[model samples]
Target: MHINPYGEDPVRLALDLINDPPGSASELGRRCAAAGLVIDVPPGAADLAETNRFLAAWLGVVDAPDETARAERLNALLAQAAAYPRLTNHAADGWHLHYRDPDRPLAAALRALISVGTALHLSGRGMHRLGRCAAAGCERPFADLSRTGRQRYCSPACANRDAVRRHRNRTAADHG
Candidate 1:
């Protein structure tokens, strides 16, 4: 039995979707497949729209002002998405637990996966392990799965850019 690390992958997938949303159903399917999700069914236009909506709601949890508010928003998502855990060996993969019903649409499956994964990530890691990038102009969402869990920017480029900006500002202040 292979235990799936639901926490990391789903959160990463959510971030990917948020950062570069799919333009169409086929694009959505391709992106999810590229992200290693099993494409049980070909997603349609409705799925694409639903996924966009779901991501918007998920962002609410990410943007929550406080831990209590974050937990509350996440709980609402879990309530809407998650189901009783069940073991399945779909696609000839080893038995693994699923938090959603079988044969669900792509959007629905993503909803469940992301909600449960976020819960596990928050509980196992830390409540502050997820947020938007700290760069002055980039508010992209990022999951802090780093070894030190101090990830503030979405990418190293953003971090470096912010560092350069701060250094230039300090240099100007000193000159003035």
Candidate 2:
């Protein structure tokens, strides 16, 4: 049923924010809008700082050593966000459930969305669906949204680069 909306877009947004953090509150707002989030508060310096703190913790979930540790870290985040789900149709066209209260500040809303979205992603997709890039020298985080759930790099560029590096090494080893 595409029940998650691909982790309901929040996971990808979280990743984007982590990988390339916004330099300013305005930029953050623009990026959130680009990602389809309806920000209730205009992003501010405090929002930027809070989001940074949240991402720092969220990255921990990405780098967790095992499923148990990962769950533990994510649980911490969920507890901090701690909001009851309520249905709303702010757009007035379609109604959907929201994990946070109505008209929350960007930072507070992000806390709920990223935490809850990540929980859904890990549970719905797989515990191993989040990780750092497999490409050597690139430690960026990635959410494995692949149909096969075998993704190893944050982007196609990293994957191709790693493949090329492997091929070159193999060729050199064969000649040596």
Q: What is the lDDT of residue 137 in candidate 1?
A: 87
State model 1's lDDT: 0.91
What residue pairs are clashing in model 2? Answer: none
Tens-place lDDT per residue, model 2, 7-125, is 74899999888888899999999998888888887989999999999999999999999999999999999999998888889867689888998787899989999999999999988
Q: Model 1 TM-score?
A: 0.94
Number of the top TM-score candidate = 2
lDDT of 2 at 19: 83
Cα RMSD to native, each candidate?
Answer: 2.4, 1.3
Where model 1 places Cα greater than 4 Å from the true spot, the runs are: 1-4
128 in model 1: Cα distance from truth in Å?
0.6
lDDT of 2: 0.90
Q: After superposition, how far is residue 6 of candidate 2 from its true place, in Å?
A: 5.5
